[model samples]
Target: MALGMNRDVFITCAVTGAGDTAGRSAKVPVTPEEIAAASIEAAEAGAAVAHIHVRDPVTKQGSRDLALYRETVRLIRASGVDVILNLTAGMGGDLTLGSVEAPLPPSAVGTDMVGATERLAHVAELLPEICTLDCGTMNFGEGDYVMTNTPAMLKAMAAQIKALGVRPEIEIFDTGHLVLAQWLEKQGLLDGPVLVQLCMGIPWGAPDDIGTLMAMVNNLPKDWIFSAFSIGRNQLPYAALAALAGGNVRVGLEDNLWLGKGVLASNGDLVAAAKTTLTSMGAKVLTAAETREKLQLKKRV
Candidate 1:
C-alpha cells in the first residue's frame, strides 16, 4: 500500500470532552454558553468542525441532558458560526465498576449505561452533521472505568444514526475497534465515505507511537476518511503527523490543555496552533463547506 500526505486537511476541534478536566484547567469550557463561545472561537481560528460534549453547569460534570445539548446547539447556531457540528454519542456508555473484586453492581458515580435509543437521543433531536460512535469497549484509563461500547450497542447506534441522516464518526480507540468498524460496515450500518477518528494515547487503548498509528492507518478501509489525534502534549505534534499520514487532524482543550510549558490553551489557541503547524508544512486547511462537501456531510441549522 503506497502512502502519501493529505494536502487538504480539515481540523476537528473537540471543544470539551467528558473528562473531569473542567477544574484542572480554567480554559476548559463548562457551561453551554462557554462551550458555544469556545466552538465559535475555534471556528474563527480555523477549525472546520467542533466536536462537542455538554456539561452540567452546577457540577461541571459531563451530562447527557437533552436540554444541555439543545441549549449548546442553539447558542452555536444563533452565533451564526459556520462550522460543522459533531456531537458526541459516546457519553451514555461509560461503565465504572465498583472494584476489581466487587464489580457486579457497578458504581453509580460513573456507570451510565443506557439503551441505544436513549444514547442517540440527542443525535436524533439535534441532527448534527456528525456524531461519534465509539467502535468498541475497552478499559478506559485508571480504575474500573471502562468506556463500554459493545458490538450490539454499536450496531444499534449506527443504524439509528444512519436512519437519522447524520454522519457517524467512527471513533477507534484500539486496533480491534477498526475490526468492529469493518463489521459494522459489513452489516450495512456505516454508509459510504465512512468517517473514522483514530483516538490515540488514551490509556488501555492504542498508544500514540508512530508505529501503532501507522498500523491503524494502514489497516483502515481504503476509501474511509479518517482523522488522527493524541491526547496531552502530543496533540499539536500529531496534527502534522496526521496530515503526513494521509488523514485529517483533531486538536482541542478536550484532548489537551497546555499550549506550551506552563501555558494553558483554549480551544481557539489549539486550533490556531494546529493550523499554523499544518500550513507551515504546506498543507491547506479546509473550511467547513469544503469539509462538508468532501465528507458528504448533511449540515443542519
Candidate 2:
C-alpha cells in the first residue's frame, strides 16, 4: 500500500462540458475558440489533461456536431498546449418521456437519441488519446429526461472505440455502473489498465459523502487507474480527498464555476486551485508526459 501511496497523481481539467451552464457564468466557454483557450489556460495552470465537449456557437447548446469537435481539437492542438485531449462520447443519448399518463409520445426537443456509432463520430475522426464511455443510463437533473445507455449500446460503442485505437475512460456514476464496467472488462471489451472516472454528487447518482466514495473506490479493480470529482462548491475539496483516497482529480468550470463566493472562476483558476490543494496534502502532481506514461496512453502527434 505504501509503495502505491507515494505515486504522483494526475489532474484532469474538464474545460467546458456540454451542459446548459453558459447563462450561469459568462466565463463558461461556448464556442470552439473559447473552449480551446480555456483548455490552454488549464494546461498552463497545471492540468495534464483536458476533458472537452463542444456546443453550438449560436445557440450555446450542447452539440454532437463533428465539425464543432474538429474545430475545438484543431484549436487546442494549434495552441501548442502540452495536454492530453479527452473527448466526450457521452452525447446524443438523452431520453425525455412524456407524462406518465401519456408516456407513449415522448417530448421532441429535449430527447435526442442516435446509434452508438453516431455518438462517437467525432472521436472516430479525431482519435483523441481518450474518450468517455458512460457505463449506464441514469436520471439526470430536474426533468422527465433520462440518459439512455443500454448495455448493448455500450458494447457496440466500446467495440468501435477500441477499433479506432482510442482508450475508453469508463465514466461510472454509481455502484451499479461499476458493476456494468466490470462486466465489460470480463467480456474483454475494455482494454487493460482500465481508466475509470468516479463522478460523485451528481443527482440520482453516487453521493459525495466519504462512505459512498469509499464504497465506489473499494469496488474498483486493483490494477485499474481512476480519477474522481464532485460538482459545485465541493469541487476543490475533492481534489485533496481523491489524492488521499488513491485516485486522480478532475476540476474545472464543468464541475464548478466559482473561485470563491461572488468570484467567477475561469478553467485555469480551478486547475490552479486544485493543484494548490493537492500540494498542500503532500501529493506530487504529475505532468502530461508522466501521466500519459502512467496511463499507458500513446503519444499525440
Tell me, what's the RMSD of every candidate?
0.8, 1.4
Best by lDDT: 1
Worst 10 residues of 2 by lDDT: 1-10
lDDT of each: 0.94, 0.90
- Against the true structure, what is each candidate's TM-score? 0.99, 0.97
Local error of candidate 2 at residue 240 (angstroms): 0.5
Stretches of candidate 2 exceeding 4 Å from the true structure: 1-7
Local distance difference test, candidate 1 = 0.94
lDDT of 1 by residue, 139-212 (tens): 97678988888888998899999999999999999999999999999989998899999999999999999999
**Candidate 1 ranges beyond 4 A from true positions:** none
**Candidate 2: clashing pairs of residues:** none
Residue range 1-301, candidate 2, lDDT tens digits: 1113434889999987878899899999999999999999999999999999999999998899899899989988887778999999989888998876786588897889999879999998898999999999999888788999999999999999888888999999999999999998898898878999999999999999988988888888888988999999999989988887889999999888899999999999999999998887788899999999998887776
